[model samples]
Structures are given as structure tokens and as C-alpha cells.
Target: MFRIFVIAVLPLFFVFSSEIFTFLSGALCPSCNCESAKPLHRIPRPQLRPEFLALENGTDARLGCEDVGYKMHVFSREPLVVYFENFVSAREREHLLDISEKIYTPSTITHNGGQTSDRNTKVRDSEVALVPRTEGVRCIERRAREVQGWREEVWIERLRVQRYNPGGHYSHHFDWSSGRGGWGRVSSFMVWVHGEELEGGGTEFPRLELRGDKKKWCKFIECEDNLDGEDSKDKGVETAEDKKGAVFKVIPGNAVYWENFRSDGTGRGYNETWHAGLPVKKGVKVGLNIWSYGRID
Candidate 1:
């Protein structure tokens, strides 16, 4: 009887040991296995600083994080701007694409003859991944929040990767929701992964209306002319201050950060921020979209 009891106890000990081993190795999880498992058909979540959340929950809200709230050391209400020195590391970037391949099994809409498009702006329909990196995203979000002077819990509500094959382009659209039950998305950031010489696709935002004919302003700002040409006037032209339109490009591994909410926090969308992706004339464009949501308890 004692021998039989020992046998059963040994098995239990082995099982418990396996559990502990998995925990220590960060390998096996009943609900998840970070090593083998990956996020599917969805964007990655924003990397939030646990210490920031703790600080807000703890006393002394005035005690601020040296690098947490404001972006790039500048506080502005219009929108915090940040440079993408390096968005993803070489190893992690490769892993991201690999995992994305598992979950990003493209449909007819995603892959095509060198062009892909997600016509639906709805987040639920779009593919995504739960990326485990946050260094780049956190930097942008904290700065945007500090500029806005709002005290809301910021989290990455959703992240989706969209690939535009050669000649692919998403038409003009705004990033903000159309006032559903969700209303706290304050801003967005798109970090570029691979950089190349491409034509036709530049993020174009509406320019401020001029006093006289809008064409006059467009001619002055000349952003539309910068990408396309004077012949593409039908695209609707607005003059921007020193060409501050949303349409932009960055080097490979560089990021482009933009805030959806203004500093006032009234939740008003920036009319000037209206933007769209022009048709890509050449080469593929792969980038990450990190959408920061307002406080969620």
C-alpha cells in the first residue's frame, strides 16, 4: 500500500514540476503559450506601462514619469509628434511577420495581383495581431496624453497590419469612429517597417480653406503637387501650413505618430486631419497601425 501511494505521489510531483517549469520558462500556459501561439486576424494591442497605471492608481498623481506621459519631451494640444528612430527590432520584426502569416491568412480582400485593400473601416472585420512590444508605442501615447492634459487610462484598443502591394492604395478617410458607444480614441500612430521608393501613395489631409478660390491655397501649399502633380486637381486641394498634411513617408524602421484628439479634449475631430492613401505606383508598403484608446477602467 505504501509503495502504491508513493507511485501516485510521484506522478503528482512531476506534473507540478512541469507547471513550475513552464512558468519559469514562460512557455506553457493553460490559456496561452507565447512561444507557440500567436494573435490572429487582428492588430496588436498597445504596450502600456504597468508603472504608469500604478502611479495613477497610487497617490501623488503629480509625480510624473520622466518618459511616460508626454511624447518626445514636447507638450502640445494640437497633436504630439514623435520621430520613429526605430520601431521594431530585426528579430522581433521578423517574428511579427511570421506570426502575422499564421493569423493573417489573407483572404481575397487582403491579397491580390500586387494590391490589397480593406474597404470596410470597421475594426472587427480587419485582421490583427497581439504584438508583445511597446517601447515605440508607449513613447507616442504618453506624450499625446500629456499634451492633451486628460487623465484617462490609455490602452491599445486594437492594432491591424495592412499591406499594400504595388499599385495598392486606400482612398481618403478619417481614422476616428463615427460616434458609436466608443468615443475615447484620442489618437493614432503608423510606424513604417520597410522603406522604399514608391509613388502615388501619400497620406493626404484636407487643407484649411482659403479666403478666395481654394485652388489658390492649394497652389500655395503645393502638397498635392509634391506627390502627384498640378493635373491631379480633382482630388480636392486645401492649403496647409508648411505642408502639414497627414500624407507622409518615413525611412524603413521609422514611425509616423499622429494624435486624433486635440489638446482641449472636447472630443472634436480635426477637420484638417481628414486624410487618405493615394494609389501606390510601385513597390509594396508594409506598416503597423497603433491606435491608442482613452481611459478604460
Candidate 2:
């Protein structure tokens, strides 16, 4: 009786197992057609989009500063003013002037009493044009950030191109604002973009005094000539014999960088950073002001 039961159960198991195997095989390879049961190969991956391919290949094409070199001379340490020779390339200067030729408008100063206003003022008599962020302009901005020892480009404000004609000047003022809230300018880079045989237009820091070699500074500053005795007392003129500070001449491709904030925790404006752009007495002077702020905004 036990052998008979085993035979019956074995046949039923074989028949059921065959049916299960056949069902699974059909589910997995429905299109096998029974001619071959070979494993299916993976479908070829879709080709990457053209934009994606371009992005993958662009990492090696970025610009570098390997060919750029510049000279720096310390003008003052208290307010941290440094003069840079050949800060901007000749081509960059020409490009800036060409792009901004028709965009110049009367320049405005920060409102008195720490208010915000865009009205034109006599305090700043030059015309200004904001240089758009083109590739050339971006290169100059990056160079400026490197010179300042800053790693981030966002700290820089928009580049300002200023045109000063005869008698045009900016009265003595501090670059950093005295009010609270948003960050004020921490430093400034003023570049002389164009000036040939330019006279009288110079950046004067009345509160800063330098005892360095006069001849050496002559290359970067106007150390040879003193302000005319009569002009020294003029209300608009801040630098005179009685009031002595370092004054940098307007030399093409050269720039003066000065720190506007104190080192203290308060981050207040440094008194020695007070400066003015003297009247342009001769040829036209075109300058670029690159201001770096404490905050990115």
C-alpha cells in the first residue's frame, strides 16, 4: 500500500512541477519563440544630449591667469593704500573706454546724513558709466580680487568708469558708509584707465602721511609737485602744504587700492581712508573704481 501511494504522488508532483516551470519560463521570456533560450543583452544606452556632452568637455577650456603679472608698492599702511603698476592691461583699458563712451552720465554721491538718493551733486563733478560684466570686465574683476587677497568675486561691486574733465573733482569723502544695516565698502581699487600727460587729477588721502622714499613713490604718486599755495586753501581742495597726505598721480594702467574699514570688531570707517579726486587741470582723465564690500549684496 505504501509503494502504491508513493507512485501516485510522484506522478502528480512531476506533472505539477512541469506546468509551474513552463508558466515561469513563458512569463520571463514571452518572445523566446522556443527557437533559442539565450539570455537577453542590455539595450544600448541612449546617446547623451549635445548640451550635456558640451558641458562635460568645457571643464578644460576655462581661462587662467598664468600670463598676468603686476607690481605693487605700499603707499600707506594705516589705511592700507597700495599702488599697483600695470594693474589693467592696455587692451582692457581700450575696451572699457570703447564700451562706455556713450553711457556716461553725471555722477552722484551718497546722500548726506546716511540717506539713499541718486540725485546729481556738485560734490562729485565727474561723469560715470558702469561697466557691464563682459568677459574682459570679469577678468579685471578677478585680477582685482586676487590683488586684494580675497578669494570670492562676489565681494566686488560693479566697476565704475569715471570721466573727469578740467575742473571736475570729487570732494573729500570716505568710501565706507557710516550708517547701520548692509555692509559698506571695505576697500577700493581706483584704476587710471586713460590719461596721457594728465595733470592735477590725483587721489589725495589727507589723513594718511607717508615717509617712504620720495623718488620711489614718484613712479606711483605725484610726490615731486606740491599743490599751489593758493589752491591748497580752497574749500574743494583737501590736500595742501599744511594738510599733507599721500597723493597718487593718474597714470594709465596703474591703480591705487585702499582699505576703508578699521580693523576693530566694529568694522567702522577708518579715518585715514578719507580721500578725494583732485580737479583735472589738463588732459581728460578716465578712471575705474572697483569697490569691494564686506557683504556680497
Candidate 3:
């Protein structure tokens, strides 16, 4: 019986010793030259230095913007569409509407063949106002750049505010231009400044397939029951009912960010990024567009 007990306990001791050896090997400081244990000393608590205190206060102040209450939802991976909740502050939205009250003019779109034209087309029926780059607008632009993972603000274009009435809508078009300029639109951030009582007026992406639960995304996107039907091959120039894509609702203070270029280093526009602004069926819808150009990263 004693020999049997010794055999059982000996294996237990070896297992415990192996675990201890592993722990000690990981805990030992590699830079320490001496193998002997050093004498224990009472280390004083670190006092708050002037610079350390200043840094702590500065960090708290910098984090104040985080409490504004916003959430990000990735709607699609390819062509990269992201939905943002409460992306704009109430003060910012009010300021934008107040400043652009009387400046709206008829909106225009680039020709389908990429030619410059002066003729008014029926494709886009909204009025657009170019928002001046004020301090507040610049702050919003900085936030948009940060959300798109861009470090520099030089790639951002001037903000354009669009006010859509019941019949206003913009047909499918690519934001990136194949013009002479070396820079192309890499991403777009469209923020809903108004649209509390509005209906319809959702941004639609025709080629993307919706994934996950329909009920959950219905809060931000206009998910339909019948999406199995094929979309129009003519680049979504037809009405909203004719197109079968992910349509994001126009919610106030919310925004949608999407990458326009392909991730395969070709720097060409993704064909799936073709989207349209659906017509507003009820009240008005005010939205702000912030386009980012140049290297996306």
C-alpha cells in the first residue's frame, strides 16, 4: 500500500514541478544578468508629475466626443458599405440647415458618356447647395475622414447638401470620375441631416446581395420581401421599383460610408458600387455628401 501511494504521488509532484518551471521561464526578465535573487526594497508610489497630470486631462478632453452616442454597422463587404447611427450632432445638423436655407440650386449629373454638358436632365430632380467649409463643417469632415480610415484631410472634397422633395431623386451613377486628374473618389459619406417625417428617399445599391437577418437591418436598410428578382441591366436609371438592391432608409443624423474602388490594387471603380437616391414619397429629405479622393488608406 505504501509503494502504491508513493507511485501515485510521485507523478503528481512531477506534473506540478513542470507547471512551475514553465511559469518561471516565462516570468524571468531576459535583460537581468544576475541569476541570484535581488533583495526586496520598498518601492515608493509614483507621484503625479505636472506633465503626467496634463496628459491625463488632455486625454479626457479628447475623449469627450466619444460620448455623442454613435454605432457602426457594416452592411456589405464588397464595395464596402457601412451604416452609421447618430453620425451628426443635433447642433451640427441645425447649423447646416440654417446656413443653406436659401442657397439651393438645381442639381446636375455628369453625362453617362463622361462628357461635360449644360442641359438639365430629368435623371436627378433634387436641389443641391454647396456648404461652405466653416469650422463646424470642417470638424464634420475630419470625423468623416477618420471613419474612412484616412489620415489626411486633403483628400476630402467640399461638402454638398442636397434637399429632396416628394418627387426628387438621383439615378444610379459612379462618384469616381475618369477625368485627367490623378485623383479619383475613393470613398463617399452621405449623412442625413433632416428627413424626420420623410418617406421613401433611400440610397439603393443595385448589385449587392443582402446577408444576415432582414428584420435587424430593416432598422437602417429598406429590405424587401422579394429581392430574388433580377435588377435592371441599364445601370438603375429606372424607378426604385424596377431596381432590386439594398436600399438604406433616410434616417436623421445617420450616414452611410462606402468604398468605391476595388481592393485588388487596380485603382478602378467597382461595378457594384453603382447606387441611386430613390425618390421621396412623402416629406422632404436633406442630406450631406462628403466625397474622399486620392489614396484610400
Clashes per candidate (backbone, < 3 Å): 15, 0, 0
In order of TM-score, best first, we have 2, 3, 1
Candidate 1 matches the true fold with a TM-score of: 0.49
Q: lDDT of all predictions, in order shown?
A: 0.46, 0.70, 0.70
Tens digit of per-residue lDDT, candidate 2, span 66-110: 344678888777668888888888888999999899999888876
| Candidate that would win on TM-score | 2
**lDDT, candidate 3, residue 158?**
69
Q: Report the lDDT tens digits of candidate 1 across residue range 45-137.
A: 444555322123233344332431212321122445443444545544454466455565332233231136553533122234444334333
Alpha carbon deviation, residue 270, candidate 3 (Å): 1.1
lDDT (0-100) at residue 264 of candidate 1?
A: 38
**Residue 19 C-alpha lDDT in model 1:** 66
What does the lDDT come to for candidate 2?
Answer: 0.70
lDDT of 3 by residue, 195-244 (tens): 98788899988787776665688777764443345544344444334335
Model 3 per-residue lDDT at 140: 80
**Best-first order by lDDT:** 2, 3, 1
Name the TM-score of candidate 3: 0.67
